[model samples]
Target chain A: MKPLTTEEIRAVIAAGKLRDNLFKATGVFCLALALIVIVALVADMVIKGSDRFTLDFFLNFASRRATQAGILSAWVGSLLVMLVTAMAAVPLGVAAGLYLEEYAKRNWLTNLIEINITNLAAVPSIVYGLLALGIFVYQFGLGQSILSAGLTLALLILPIIIVATREAIRAIPAMIREGSMAVGATRWQTCRYHIVPYAMPGILTGVIIGLARAIGETAPIITIGALTFIAFLPPAPLSTLGDGSTAGLFDWVMAPFTVMPIQIFNWTSRPDPAFEVNAAAAGFVLMAMVLSMNAVAIFLRYKMRKNIKW
Target chain B: MQIHDNPTLKAEARNLNFFYGEAKALKNINMPIYDKKVTALIGPSGCGKSTYLRSFNRMHDLYPGNRYEGEIRFFPDNTNLLAAEVDPIEVRMRIGMVFQKPNPFPKSIFENVAYGLRVRGENNKRVLDDKVEHALKGAAIWDEVKDRLADLASNLSGGQQQRLCIARALATDPELLLFDEPTSALDPIATGAIEELIHELKKRVTILIVTHNMQQAARVSDYTAYMFLGEMVEFGKTDEIFIKPKDKRTEDYITGRMG
Candidate 1:
């Protein structure tokens, strides 16, 4: 074939250049679109809710008058529910993760369990809410309390934590295990000191993310019959005021409660227009809580990465 | 495989046959490992030298589908280490191992060496500090790392890390040490330093080293076993084996005629 002229070659090179720019521009446009939507939505919530975002809004209980409404009981309930969720989920999830990654045999039974856990993470949160309603609230007679709500949220996030733990455990080099065993350490002792410490940062990152999700969960709590108009705080776990005469730990766990998301949902659905401002304000508070939790996780991950080199 | 001259036999393998799944990796093999002496196993790649070393401490138990038939007997106790009633963990404690590559824990240098003592319930601070120092000194790395005991072991160079692993094994005071190509990953200088350390270590512990370097086998080991495929071709004193091998294959290997 005859060689093409230099002018023809220039035209083909220019066309390739145009295609490269098109792809790069498209990627930038997609990222900018996503960021703009998030900023706009957050700004809208902050502006609409600015008037109701006062200390009084945090102190006062939910009321019929929109101006008088506050998230006192909602915030408290959210904090208590999250505490219970973490206490229940962390140990169980880490143990299950460790067992599957370190001890479980690579048989069809373990394979089935592994596949099921992955599928569970993808299932709808509302499905978990329904399951909690049937089992914890009705069948077990936990009865629309903080314990039932916390347990429901725990089940919803267990798969997430376990998967994260497994990933963390898998990241460790097999050489470390061999070195430990070579020194006469038992399998459990090696895992306890060497393997677990090495894997902690990863496991903690996963657990915190799971907790952040648990804090924002509304459907499961709602399905478990958590009240939207709670007016009083759950009992305190420990009170050193006078001879232990105040609310005991049992009351806190068994008391009826409502979280921020459920409270915001209730206010938004109300017929009163003033309650709409109240709802946006509650949404702002909820978003702040979730964002702060995630920020902590990110900070911890950075510190861990810096402390470890290999 | 009967030997009556050496009265200080620390360990002995009799009719050992090893298999992975249905494929055999080693044929019936017997060799005597003497106390306070350094023995080297030199062979070409995939010759089962490392497999033979790993069998001493039962590292093969880590995986499934690996089978061992025959016996490895420990002297003084006359215990068959491969017997069903024997605890693999106990056997490992008595027979320490260093792998082909340096594998240090992601911890402080002090902690890496102290791990063996801590696992065995020696929590006294004074006792741990003493043993850690002694072991590090024994590995010939105390002077270089004495100031940075609290620093992470991963920060050390490859040679230092390997020495730290040796110290970790020594901290437990094992009578026998297995080195599986311990210097193959090191530079020539590091390899020389380690060979020197192995010479020193033989005074206190029995050493079985598997090496691909024929010169290393001659330089460091008191006795040498030349293996090919899955069988032992010859076993004798280091000087005798290097100068005049019994088997044609052994002579061919050392002289660079064939692997």
Candidate 2:
């Protein structure tokens, strides 16, 4: 075939540029659409709940009067349940991930385990609640308390943390491992000195993402029998009780709890329109909590990754 | 084997064979590594030069299903390095390695060199400082990094990083050191610096190096072994091998008629 003239070449180039511009426009439009929807939802919540943004709104307990209804118990329970979830999941997930990546042999058994773990991440969160209800609440007889709800959320996020850990570990170059081993260091030495530190940023990101997801998990929390009208907070770990007796350090974990999402769900289902305002305010608060967790994840990742390079 | 000037044997491979999960990579081979001398293995890609070099420290044991037959006998103790009961970690403790690319840990320069000693449970600060300094000086990179040992190792240039890796290997005072094309990723000036460092290093430690460059073998090694398709084609004094190779394949490879 004969070569094309300069004009024909220019025409072809123009067509390709047009297509590229069209694709760029399409991507920008899609991004803008998502951003607009999120912004609108946040704006609506803020405007509807503007009257209830006082300091008293955060300090009061659930009352029959809408003006007196507050999220004191709801926020505290959410915080405590998240504390349990993080404590339970981080160690178990990180250890399992480290073992799978650095120690386990490549065989059919390992392959089966890997596949099952991936599948577990996609399983419904409510299923974990049901399992916790059977094992933690009934069989283990922990009661429908903060411990059961926390344990349920931990189960729901375990797969996320594990998968994240594996990916973070895998990102480290093989040469680094080989370099450490060549210096007469054993397997455990290599992991402790190099692998764990290098992969810390990625692991932190995964942990925060998992916690963010668990914070808004209403289905699992409700299924595990969280109360919707709790007036008192879980017992302070070392504070004096109303009857003047000292509370146990671990007493808070066993107290019946109500989280932010459960309170919102209860308010939205009420007959009075005033309760709807409470739901909007609580929803915004939950969104802020999740966003702040994500921000912390991003900051930690940046700080940790500052020194590492390929 | 041809006669030499009665060099001391630091280690020897006796009927050594290696297999990567059923496919034989190194055939039966026997070669002696002389104490305090540099030995270079020269071959084309996929010719098992690296496989042979890695066997000295049992680097292959890190992966599953890679099997070793016969023995790599270590000197002074006559330990069979490839034996089932012999820990690869113990073998590696006496032998160190540098890879093709510079791989400094994401840590302070001092910590990078202090790592091997730390693994051996050396925790005293003064002892670590002296050893790390000596290693950096031995690798010929002390003056440039003396003030910034606290800085991250990854901040250095590629050549500096490579020399830091050498210091890392040298901090433990191994009996033998392995270089797997350590300067292949470097510029000509950096390569020359590494070659000079290797000449100085041979006074204290036995060295085994694998190289794709023929001229590198001629410049740095006292003895040379030519490998092709997992077999030792020739082994002799470096001058003899470069000037007049014994095997037809070795001659062809040296003359650039074949790979």
Candidate 3:
């Protein structure tokens, strides 16, 4: 075969560069498209709800008049639910992930469990609500309370946390584990001293992402029968109840609640145009909550990962 | 196998065989490790030198489907390390290892050295400080890191990180120390430093090191075993093996004729 002339080689190089530039431009366009959509949605919400963005909008309870309604009960309920979700899921998911990654043998049963966990992450969120309804609500006699909603969200995010934990643990080199064990450290000792600490940053990211998803989960919260208009907050710990009895520390967990999604859902469906503005404002607040949670994840991950290296 | 001094046996591998699932990695092998002496295993890649070294501390047990047949007798107690009832962790406790790459935990320098002692449940601050200092001094890295024990270990140079790993292994005061190509990842200066440290370390602990570098085996080891294709080709004093190898394959491998 004859060697290519200089012009021919130049043309070939130019063609390759053209393809590269095309792919680069396409990638940038796709990314920009996603960013623009999210930005537009947030801007639209903020603009439409500007009138209802006052301090009273957050201080007052849900009222008959849309202008007077506030997210006082809704925000509190969302925070409380998230607290329970994190408490339940972090330990459970992290422990399960550690076991599966570090301890479990490569057998059929473990393989089965592994496949199921990955599949569970893709299951509809509403299924978890139904499961929580049966197990936590009726079977455990927990009713439609904060405990039920939190546990339901916990179940929803468990698979995500488990997968993330596994990925993080796997990222740790085998030599580290061997180094720990070679010092006469037991399996538990290695896990406690090395594995858990190293995997913490990743696990924290997963937990926050899961909670962010759970915060905006309207279907599950609604399916589990959350109240849309809660006038009163859950009784504070050690505070005297209406019946003259002091509330227990965990009394809030069992109290009826209204989360942001349910409140937003209720307002959007109302007949009055004023209620639409309430929904828009509440949506922005909820979006801000999710975005702030993500920011915390990124910051914490950066801080914790600063010292870690292979 | 022959030794001019007839040193006391620290550990003995008797007819040992190792399997990684269905594949036999190490054939029947019998070798003796002298008390407080450095023994080096020299071989090419896929020759199972590292495999033989890992067997001393039951390092293979960490992974599933890996099996050990025959006994690796630990001296004094005569415990069969490869026995079914013998816990790998217990074996590991009595022995320590340093890998090819430096693997300091994502922790402070002090914590990295004190990790072994901590695993043994030594939590008192004074005790940890003293032991960590001693270990670091023993590994010949105390001067470089003594003032900054609180600094993260990963921030150190590659050679310094390796010495920190040595300090970590030394902290536990194990009877046997295994080095699997520990200096392979280091530069010439760092390699020289590690070689000198290894020479100094054998006074307190028995050493078994696997190396791809023939000169390293000759420099640091009192006794050298040449391995090829999962088998021990020859074992003798380092001087005798280097000067006049008994096996043809050992001679060829040493003379750079073949791997």
Candidate 2 docking DockQ: 0.86
Candidate 2 segments exceeding 4 Å error: B1-4
Better of 2 and 3 by TM-score: 2
Candidate 1 per-residue C-alpha lDDT over A153-253 given as tens digits, one digit per residue, 9 for 90 to 100: 89988999999999998998887887888777787897899777788889988888898898988888888889988788876766543455776667789
Instruction: Give the true-contact fraction for every prediction, in order.
Output: 0.69, 0.82, 0.88
Minimal lDDT window, size 10, model 1 chain B: B1-10
RMSD of each: 3.3, 1.6, 1.6
Ranking by DockQ: 3, 2, 1
Tell me the TM-score of chain B in each candidate: 0.97, 0.98, 0.98
lDDT of 2 by residue, A1-310 (tens): 9999999999999999999999999999999999999999999999998888988889988889998999999999999999999999999999899999999999999999999999999999888888988899999998889999989999999999999999999999999999999999988999999998898998998899899999999998888799999889888978999999999999999999999999999999999999999999989999999999899889889999998997
lDDT of 3 by residue, B160-240 (tens): 999999999999898999999999899999999999999899889999999999999998999999999999889989999
What docking grade applies to model 1? medium
Q: For each candidate, what is the lDDT?
A: 0.89, 0.94, 0.93
Give the top-scoring candidate (TM-score): 2
How do these models rank on lDDT, best leading?
2, 3, 1
lDDT of 1 by residue, B1-259 (tens): 2223564989998999999889888888899988888899998898899988998898887777888999999987978888878988899989999888898887899998999899889999999999999999999999999999999898999989899999999999998999999988899998888999999998899999999999999999888999888898799888889999989999999999877
